[model samples]
Target: MRILLIEDDDLIVESLTKALTEQHYVVDVATDGETGWELAEAFVYNLILLDVVLPKLDGFSLCQRLRSQGNQTPILLLTAQDTSTSKVTGLDAGADDYLAKPFDMSEWLARMRALLRRGGASLPPLLEWRNLQLDPSTCEVTCNGQPLHLPPKEYELLELLG
Candidate 1:
């Protein structure tokens, strides 16, 4: 899975990146909301981890903009703001989930998995185009019963095409 992490805090970014990478997730980091938005526009990610307070643009605005543009990528807002109003605003702005600061990594990972599983509402458990078969949950592809070795980008492209 690929994740776009938009956070300005270097320490948090480093820790999260390390943990996610160790779990075999491809992570891209953006220090500011503008850069994050640009990257999000240019690439297709399974999930976006956005911090509420951001430079150039706040997470709420970014989430709203992405939704306005019809970007359906699951967005998980990470913020220090832990109030009911803030959580409501984030969800109202189109965030799929929210995680407060100082959150446990396991909880974050669990939420991410849930979002990813629920994100592709129309996607089937198995995709087949001619002899090509793809099982997204396992990241396994096969052609005529033979396993196909695909790099991450290729796999993503195939999934998109499928």
Candidate 2:
């Protein structure tokens, strides 16, 4: 999955970036809301992890502005404020989910997976083109139901072609 992480805390940013990269996700990090917003607007991210408090602009305004611009990318608000009002504000600003700070990595992974699945990330196991069938989940391919056993690059090319 491609994710945009908007955070100001250096430690949190570094840790989350490492974790997500280790899980084979493509991550783009921005330290402030301004840079984050620019990247978010320029790219089609599968998910966005936005911090509530940020330099230049806050997450709520960023989320709202993005929504206003017709960007419907799933946004998960990451905030230290764990209150009813804060959660409601995030939701009202168009966040798909809210995760309080000090959250477990496992929970974040699960939440991201859930959101992606809801967006149809779990499509059919196979994508067929001509005699080629690609299974993205496993990075495997088969031709006419027989395993092709392609190298990673070959499989990726076939997937791109298909």
Per-candidate Cα lDDT values, in order, are: 0.90, 0.84
lDDT of 2 by residue, 41-120 (tens): 78888789999999999999999999999988889999999999999999999999999999999999889877766667
Number of backbone-clashing residue pairs for each candidate, in the order shown: 0, 0
lDDT of 1 by residue, 1-162 (tens): 678999999999999998876555679999999999999999989889999999999999999999999999999999999999999999999999999998998899899888988977733479888888998755789999999887766877787887
Instruction: List residue ranges in candidate 2 displaced over 4 A.
Output: 121-162
**Which residue pairs overlap in candidate 2's backbone?**
none
Model 2: what TM-score? 0.78
- What is the number of residue pairs that collide in model 2? 0
For residue 112, model 1's alpha carbon misses the true position, in angstroms, by: 0.4
Locate the minimum summed-lDDT window of 10 residues in model 1: 116-125
